[model samples]
Target: MNLVSVQDLIEAGRQVSLTGSALAEQAKKGTPKQREYLYGLLVAGVEGLEGFRLFFRPFPRGSRA
Candidate 1:
């Protein structure tokens, strides 16, 4: 079993947050092809968030109980 440190998790969360921000920026004026690319990224981000959830204890507070 691989162990992840708190710092690693924080970095991953930051990266995902950045991805979401970029997605929003692109969505505002992106072409169809660009939007499709953003959709793929959004799906990947969701999967990443799910993976983070598994590592967390007590469900991480604010997120859906």
Candidate 2:
């Protein structure tokens, strides 16, 4: 499993105007739409990080650079 830092989640929350534990709470108890929105934000944020780019890449066999 890929582990996401709390900092990244907080940043994603900031992008949506959420602050502090608000995002983490919503992630745990929010409606499906809210969870999905958070998921998207987290994924985008993680994918944007240089260290995580490789984990998100989908390369065919022998095609990875």
Candidate 3:
């Protein structure tokens, strides 16, 4: 998938819970390519956070959302 779609998927992941649960352990999520693509999504998310902080903006900032 492209970075844009990957970024969207990353954001969607934030809405779901997988911590401290059996599913979290059992879930074998993402393919090798997808896993690699996660780095880009992470970078995008960080950049979005930086933009929000620097501009003192609200959530879901910019074209990232």
Candidate 4:
């Protein structure tokens, strides 16, 4: 598994926006229908983070990174 820093993710998002993400700006007149896919990903990420932060008990010190 690869670990990604928040800063890296932010930079990637900026690049995606600047480049006009395909799913978000491919149509001729308006936004693409799949634009909302980004929102779904954000929602899922938030929920998953919440679970990892709140639902699990802490591991013993020096367990896993």
Using TM-score as the measure, which candidate wins? 1
lDDT of 2 by residue, 1-65 (tens): 34444555677667545685977765566655656666677667655674566777678898756
Residue pairs in candidate 3 whose N, alpha carbon or C atoms collide under 3 angstroms: none
The lowest-lDDT stretch of 10 consecutive residues in candidate 3 is 18-27
Candidate 1 error regions (>4 Å): 1-28, 58-65
Of 2 and 4, the candidate ahead on lDDT is: 2
lDDT per model vs. reference:
0.55, 0.63, 0.50, 0.46
Ranking by TM-score: 1, 3, 2, 4
lDDT of 4 by residue, 1-65 (tens): 23433333344445334343442343223333333444445456666767777878787898994
Q: Backbone collision count in every prediction?
A: 0, 0, 0, 0
Q: Scored by Cα lDDT, where does model 3 land?
A: 0.50
lDDT tens string, model 1, 1-65? 23433333334445566554544554556665655555556557868788888777476567895
* lDDT for 1 (candidate 3): 41
Better of 2 and 3 by lDDT: 2
CA-only RMSD, every prediction: 14.2, 9.6, 10.7, 11.1
lDDT computed for candidate 2 = 0.63
- Winning candidate number (lDDT): 2
